[model samples]
Target: MSGKTRIALVTGGSGGIGRVVATRLAADGMTVVVHYAGNPAPAEEVAKEIAGAGGSAVTLQADVTEPERVRELFDAVEQQFGGVDVVVNTAGVMILKPVTELDVDDLDRMLRLNVRGAFLVSQEAARRLRAGGALINFATTVRKLALPTYAGYAASKAAVEALTPILAKELRGRDVTVNAVAPGPTATPFFFKGKPQEVIDQMSKAAPLERLGEPADAAEAVAFLAGPARWVNGQTVFVNGGVI
Candidate 1:
């Protein structure tokens, strides 16, 4: 690979956990590409933060659900950084509603981003990633817990889990490990939004660890998979503090 610096493209890099993952990878010595969907400000801030910390990073925008945009994203990365060595598909949305109450439109929107977006990213990664690269997708621990009102979100992430190992097998000789990181309740603004204090407290204590997962905790797992956990393939690593 010409001894070029490894590059990592993190989708939704502007969001809570996504921001942390991007910085963590950059700190791990990879040139980071912070990909955002709608807003560039946050993404640019993340890139600048990484650069300020003496790491290399840049911002890119792409709607993961769109094929052409995703392709262009890869093209830009390849042209600028040589080639992508890691892709963390953290771009996803969660719409909480019980099965009976879930609006079909909301379900469709979530599926479009969470499932289809993941597929598009995985497809491109399979086609373009360097031999030693790894593709990490996002899943959720709710898929295993089967919590109420999370039916739609859980279903979407469940699909992600299903495709993970299959993608890994399909990439057999390519040497690109395909895996998903499933995070439990994490201490992110997204997690705390609109939830009551009592509810948050109960969730915080639900895990045997007696606390909510941190963004850095999830970031650590991603760093492991992105760099040294080459032997871990086609599996969903739960970073939820034993929450299931």
Candidate 2:
């Protein structure tokens, strides 16, 4: 990299993992665009923290599943920051249910937000990124474990995984790297809300690391992929702490 201020667009930047990724990237000196789907408060909070820490950041609201909105999101980033150097797709929805109980609408929603959203964001990033930039997509360890009630969500992540290789090839000779990060049972609000403490404890003990993953832990991996890791491309770095 040329040591210029790099720009990063993190989708779902208002949420737990996304917030950590955005903050960490900013701390690493990358100008961050915190993209949120519905709520802007959390995104703005993150942006303010970055600024307070002497880093540059901005909060933007956009539904990644919408092509026009995604285009606008990137356009605004380009207008403000010159161009994007890193793109992370953390926008996802989980509607857990057995395959038999999965509603068509729910399935469509998962596919739209998880699969199509990643594709659209990656496409735009590929089109706009400066050479040596990186694109990181969020997948899940559920694809490996094949857990019950997560078929739809897992399938969506699997689609993301499948796209990484082709995207890497498509971006060949451009010096931009594409990759995915799959986190397992992280200690995010989404994983803890409404869940029994006993169940959470048991789940934590199942991982080889003997605790739930932290958002910062996953964000660390994301940071690596975004900068100074150009050699690691077209791969899924599983951040489940050795969980099978």
Candidate 3:
């Protein structure tokens, strides 16, 4: 590694998978910019934790779906860290419902965040990431499983999986990788929000591993794609314990 440390911008780092990704990258010695959309408390705590552990971190906020706010976010990162070498976009919302049962607003919200928001983030990252950079988008194993009540969410993430490789090719000789990490049912507040034990148990048994994935497990994959995995561009690396 060179004396010049790498910089990372982890969107949605306020909590869950994003927070873990930020912390792990910091441990890898990259100065991380933890991004949040609304509240900054969780992000601030994350930054403090990173600093306390001898890693460098700073918290920033932006609306992932909006272009101007996203631009402002990259500006903040540039001013603070010189340039970004890794961009792990974990900012998204998952609203599950059967396609027939979903209201227009529900579908709209999911598409805006999961699809449009990811596009906007990729656009900015493509424009700004320095050489040897990476852009890892988030997808879910549900797209592969085709389970009930995930119609809208699955469709949006499927789009993410589809576009990721093309983005990698677009970057051509830039040496920036573009990939998507698709995690199985992870044990997090977002995953357990309203499910009963039986439903959770059923899901737990659905995967061959018979357990929900940990957020840290997915983070490890992202860390790999961000650093030293230059040949891993343009693919959806499934972090789901063989959950086909």
Candidate 4:
């Protein structure tokens, strides 16, 4: 922490877990690259908060599923921050549907964003991340729970988990660690939106902790993996409060 300020790139910095993770990394002394796909306002707000707190941050927009956009994102980070020390892929879309009823467009959208997007961003990060830097991808507890309506979404996250070990091995010589975090039933706006209050309460109580996970809860795990946890590689740390 005494050398050059670390640089962290967090995809989907406009939303729940990503926003919290970016802010926490800034607080931890990393110069943050807050990346958003379509929403710049919220991303800028997160960066502004970091700046107000005396931390350094910038916002970049990229559709990570597109290889060219992903490349541009890394280039912008390099231009601004000099080099990247940590990369977090938290940009994702979830469309819940039973396999038989799943829309083809929705399936493709999830695959493109959750799987292809993650791979592209991770590849770029792997190329640029310094030795001792970390690459973190966001997965989901649905991969384990196999909930009825989440087949496609879970399949995509399962791909992410599959890619984690391969990327870790690919980056082994560089001393760059790769891992995934799977969070369950978080109390993010996305989770509570349009859902019945009773259903939300039931889901919250299902976890052993008897509460929905918070954005800060997952961010804590991301922060740990980003720093001072070199031994934890190619692993998926579940931040589900023992729901699974």
Candidate 5:
């Protein structure tokens, strides 16, 4: 490629695992675009942290589910950086409920962000990313574990898993790899929300590693797909410490 620095757009980079992934990519020397849906404060903070560490990063806002907004997000990045080389789609939501108790509104919310948002972003990445680029999407290990109260979330992530490999093949000859990172029971604030202590304890120890995943754990996997894992394409790399 040219001597220009690589550019990476990380959706939902304002918080949770997305924040760490943005930070990690910046540290690895890619110019990071931190994309947030609503709030810009957290996204700004992430950019500041990366800047302080001598890494290049800028914050951008977009409703990822909206095609126009997603295109704008990439447009801004490309206009400023010349072109994007890595696109990490970490923008998504999770709503836990048994199928019988499922609230249709909650399911729609999850699907809209998790599946539709993922598709819009992936579509842009597939069309625009530079050669040798990579697009890493987020999934959840619960899809395979088949846990209770996760039907809505799992179904949405299942769509993410399903689309990953297909997108990789579609990008054939472009040298850009498409993959998903399925994190299991990560200890983000969102993960602990609405869960009791007992339930948290149980999940923390479910993995053979005997603890919940940290955002950094998942970030490491994304880093691999974003950078050195050249042959690893169209696959969901489970970052759950073997929970399944």
Candidate 6:
């Protein structure tokens, strides 16, 4: 709020989609804080790359599931950069299985990171971000596809989609926008893990684009929502390649 440079804090910045979002925002002249949970190496590399490219960036580690840590995350941004302008919550866990074979532990993990972690990061963003700030949360297009194996994971993301509008409304007149990005079949480590190549190919063909989404594809949407899309709020923009 005190500096001319806009500040953006991207959670899960060590990962595929998150890292791209952080990098893109920094390229747009926003000071980006790359947040990681357990992994620091990737976050560090991303930050280094940004600085090398003449963009401003800093890497921070925080467990978004912890309220104190989430609060401190915002505090660090405010303390160092004067204030935060955009908060992108890309931290989440995905566990896929049909309802009949789903493990409760997997479901719990999904809710903990995908739902609870997102809420915590978004909550802090709402409290600390200056006017014109934007809060972007990650959702999944699988929810609309109604994919059978994603029962547990989709349910968790469903909660995230459901929260966007309410949070946006609560911030009414504050000039803060709250929204979600639902990416489908992205070519990220998080998506490739545990899946066979054949399944991946099939899903890719499911999209009219006939390919898995690249991290940049999703980041482009985030960049727009994070900045000039001020009139767009309380909505979930699907980043799938015409799948849903």
Q: Poorest 10 consecutive residues of model 2 by lDDT?
A: 188-197
**Compared with the true structure, what per-residue lDDT tens digits does model 2 show for residues 178-211?**
9999999999887887568997898898787799
Better of 4 and 5 by lDDT: 5
Relative to the true structure, candidate 1 reaches a TM of: 0.97
List ranges where model 1 is wrong by over 4 Å. Answer: 1-3
- Pull out the clashing pairs in model 2: none
* lDDT of model number 4: 0.92
User: Candidate 6: TM-score?
Assistant: 0.97
Off by over 4 Å in 4: none
Q: What lDDT does model 3 reach?
A: 0.91
Candidate 3 stretches greater than 4 Å from native: none
* Residue lDDT tens for model 1, 1-244: 3356789999999989999999999998899999999879999999999999999999988889999999999999999978899999999888777798989999999999999999999999999999999999999999898888889999899999999999999999988999999999999887888788999999999999999999999999999999889899999999998888
Clashes of each: 0, 0, 0, 0, 0, 0
lDDT of 4 by residue, 154-181 (tens): 9999999999989899876788999999
lDDT, candidate 1, residue 210? 100
The alpha-carbon lDDT assigned to residue 42 of candidate 3 equals: 97
Candidate 5 similarity to native, TM-score: 0.98
- Candidate 3 least-lDDT 10 residues: 1-10
What residue pairs are clashing in model 1? none
lDDT of each: 0.93, 0.92, 0.91, 0.92, 0.93, 0.91
Candidate 6 residue lDDT tens string, 1-244: 3348899999998778998999999998898999999868999999999999999999888888889998888888888988899999898888878899988988898899999999998888888889888999999999999987898989899999999999999998899999999999899988999999899889989988899999999999999998889899999999999997
Q: Tell me the alpha-carbon RMSD of every candidate.
A: 1.1, 1.1, 1.1, 1.2, 0.9, 1.4
